[model samples]
Target: MERIITVRAEINLFDGSRSGKTTGYKSGIRPNHFFEGQTSSIAGDIQFEGQDELALGGKCFAIVRFLYPEWFPPVVPGITWRLHEGLRHVGDGRVLEVHSGR
Candidate 1:
């Protein structure tokens, strides 16, 4: 079975221009093992709930892919995952919240 998890992530797109270009590093959510050979990005709107207090770059609805049932690990609510920087996992704000996609 295929499972797609939706997460409300606080993504920090490096220090660069937001001019409709894919610039800067996406500092959040290490891609699940299922999306090994495929390219993906979190697409969602910018949330401003706690912008001032947190000073986060922006918030968005990131789609986390778990192509198979076994691909997903036991997750705890409100636990943040580090972002992928090339082969390394760095940074923070990759909060995951699983939804029932039945």
Candidate 2:
């Protein structure tokens, strides 16, 4: 069974990312979540605050939904994570709240 989870976090996209120059990113973007020592990407969706486009490279609070939250290590406040596209590290974030989980 899929136990999806929602988490609120403050994210910052790397200024060097390919899409980093884009003015804004829409919600519902599927970015891989990578935590410490993790070698694989955990599928997740990002819902930016206000459900509107958000500027990259700036600290932005967002709600992320993990499709396989159980596959990840225990998520708690202050735990940092990285967002990736394939092998490229696009952004980074810190967990603020675990809204729901398995």
Candidate 3:
């Protein structure tokens, strides 16, 4: 069975101040910024351990993990940074397709 999971990338903005404040616009709240060029695709396998009906029907839950790049451009306040986008198969197994919400 094959499954495609689409995901949108977001950056969490936090204030560097010791007072634990969030940096954003006048609202003091930062919204999730979805960009057109900041998306990744990861492929992996889904293994079921039991005979549950949902598992058999390919409806079982899965958790996929991946590593982000060690180097990224410097972040600027009030600006969302999106570097790359598209689908690239990094491995072979079940397929998980991630798409960026622009």
Candidate 4:
């Protein structure tokens, strides 16, 4: 039998305009989550993590430990503000959508 679905998905793409274009990477499988920013402060769904200084807020800490120091991209700075398309609550595992300042 064919699997039944109730909701339709939207197509999100990343335009070259820089700052998240009020959109996302086009025509790709939307990742369950993406890197919010690079800083001591993190806010998003937790992965393999533990308690630390940046972990005080009870939310996911920014994943700065795993990235290269020189890889700091302009579009993605050290700190970013999380974005919510709908209802968002602390510790809800929502990703911070920092306005991509081009």
Model 4 worst lDDT run, 10 consecutive residues:
2-11
TM-score of each: 0.38, 0.82, 0.19, 0.21
lDDT of 4 by residue, 5-51 (tens): 11111112223242223332222211232335534322222222243
lDDT of 2 by residue, 1-102 (tens): 457878999888766456534455578888788888877767788888865766666668999988764556677888888887777677888889999883
Model 2 ranges off by over 4 Å: 17-24, 69-71
Candidate with best lDDT: 2
Worst 10 residues of 3 by lDDT: 83-92
lDDT of each: 0.39, 0.77, 0.25, 0.27
Question: Which digits, one per residue and each the tens of the lDDT, describe model 1 over residues 23-98?
Answer: 3334232432312233443322223233322222434444444333433454345655544445443334455565
Sorted by TM-score (best first), the order is: 2, 1, 4, 3
| Worst lDDT 10-window in candidate 2 | 16-25
State the lDDT of candidate 3 residue by residue for 1-102, as single tens digits. Answer: 223332322222222242133322221112222222455432322222232222111222222222223232222223333211132111112213333211
Model 3: residue 79 alpha-carbon error in angstroms: 23
Q: With candidate 2 superimposed using the best TM-score fit, by how many Å does residue 26's alpha carbon deviate from the native?
A: 1.3
Candidate 1 accuracy as lDDT: 0.39
Model 4, position 9, has a per-residue lDDT of 16
